[model samples]
Target: MSDGNAKKTSSKESFLPQIFYNALLVGIMAGISWYAQKHSVTAGEFVGAFASIPLPVVLFAMVMDYLFDTGSLYRKVAGKKGLTGAITALGVAGFFFITMTWLVAGTITMNFSTITPVIYVVAGLLTLLLLWPKTGTTHFVLLYYIAVQLITKFAHFTLLGGVSLG
Candidate 1:
């Protein structure tokens, strides 16, 4: 095969793995949530609740988060010549919070004070560890797990009328 064809084929092959990985992550999250809900609610109720959620909204929120994160990281790594890194990071953080709040609507209440310290500590540790060499994938997976937890909590609040705030 020509060099151009080989490059195209390699990129296409790489894309499939990423899609499969994301699908697997979603499936695992769904399975765990289903099992937890099944113990408290009937199967029909669980199905109804799951079916009521707007998939597009959830996907859009996730995609926005992913994009903001990528942009912030890119700025930090490639645009470090000035205050661009800090500005981009702050903007991305604000955007993420705004997007998450919009996605949840008024269905969930969050007590930021109660969780702020824990979030800071965990985030700090993760950031430090992720800065170390060869830890990017592991840290990303951990972050994804945190994202899944938040998603599950939002789903519960929206679908099952669960109290999310302490």
Candidate 2:
């Protein structure tokens, strides 16, 4: 590729999004504690901090897959049969968490436990949504997952720390 194109591509892939995400996560943690203090004495700062952990959460999900016979994730979910639906849901959620973790950590020091609760809530919701009696439409499942992800993350920040996203 030409030097001009390379430069343009590099500029487009700037670290703005990554920096923004980190700031947002930290803000959420602080907000969770502040919000909780309004109602109760404890700010729930620990919960907020723990919610930021991602490795353990991903690890637990992997273990769950092994125990539940979620082998060959691709084949099982390709046809959307039986437990395959649930497996697919888990795989997608897992991938998101893992990607988010790597983006934030990026070889720097990190506190894994800080994100566990958030991941736990997300994975739990995904599992439940996948297991629920299907409406025969995958669209609903995907929508449900997205909705749950937003709601849970919001609640984790607000209720736990009184933190506001905006």
Candidate 3:
């Protein structure tokens, strides 16, 4: 390629869009919080500064997963056809996610002991949404995952007040 074309391409592919996305995430959260507090809406609860990850971090992780993942674990269970086999696969996937979440969270929540089973199933299904070959590795799935985080936090703050499930 010509130097002129390369320079044009680089200029067109500037970091502004990524910066906009990051700004949008922060702005949405802050706006929701501000509106809720100003209106005397119930602040759900403070999960923690560490409860959820930011959009940029999750986006970076998705890129890394796309580049480096072997898909061995996903492949192992994703091929099951029988109902019982599928259920087992779901359970295993759920267990793996919950354990990872716990490890990352570091501090245990007050409600952990009481709701382990429910959370396990939900988390499993969610993980599978991205693990399924038809959907998991797609560019849109990563965007959807981060979008979910954004919407969820917005809902929690706007409706429940500060956090979720308060």
Compare the candidates by TM-score and give the number of the best one: 3
Question: Candidate 2 at residue 73, lDDT?
Answer: 41
Writing each residue's lDDT as its tens digit, candidate 1 over 1-166 gives 9999999987775565444433433544454455445445454443334333344444444444344345455335323333443344445444544444333332334644333222222232223232222344333533443454465664443322222333
Q: In model 2, where do residues sit more than 4 Å from their true spots?
A: 1-12, 43-166
Q: Sorted on TM-score, highest at the top, how do the candidates line up?
A: 3, 1, 2
Tens digit of lDDT per residue, candidate 2, span 125-160?
334333222322344433433454464574432222
Q: Which regions of candidate 1 deviate over 4 angstroms?
A: 1-54, 66-78, 107-166
Ranking by lDDT: 3, 1, 2
All candidates' lDDT scores? 0.41, 0.40, 0.43
Query: Among these predicted structures, which one has the highest lDDT?
Result: 3
Kindly give the stretch of ten consecutive residues in candidate 3 with the minimal lDDT sum. 157-166
Q: State each candidate's clash count.
A: 0, 20, 6
In candidate 3, what are the lDDT values of residues 1-166, reduced to their tens digit? 9999999976654444334433433544455456445544432222222124344434543553453235665444433434444565547645645543343233346667553332333233334443434443676535654455565664422211122331
TM-score of every candidate relative to the true structure:
0.30, 0.24, 0.36
Candidate 3: list runs displaced more than 4 Å. Answer: 1-51, 55-72, 81-84, 103-106, 109-125, 145-166
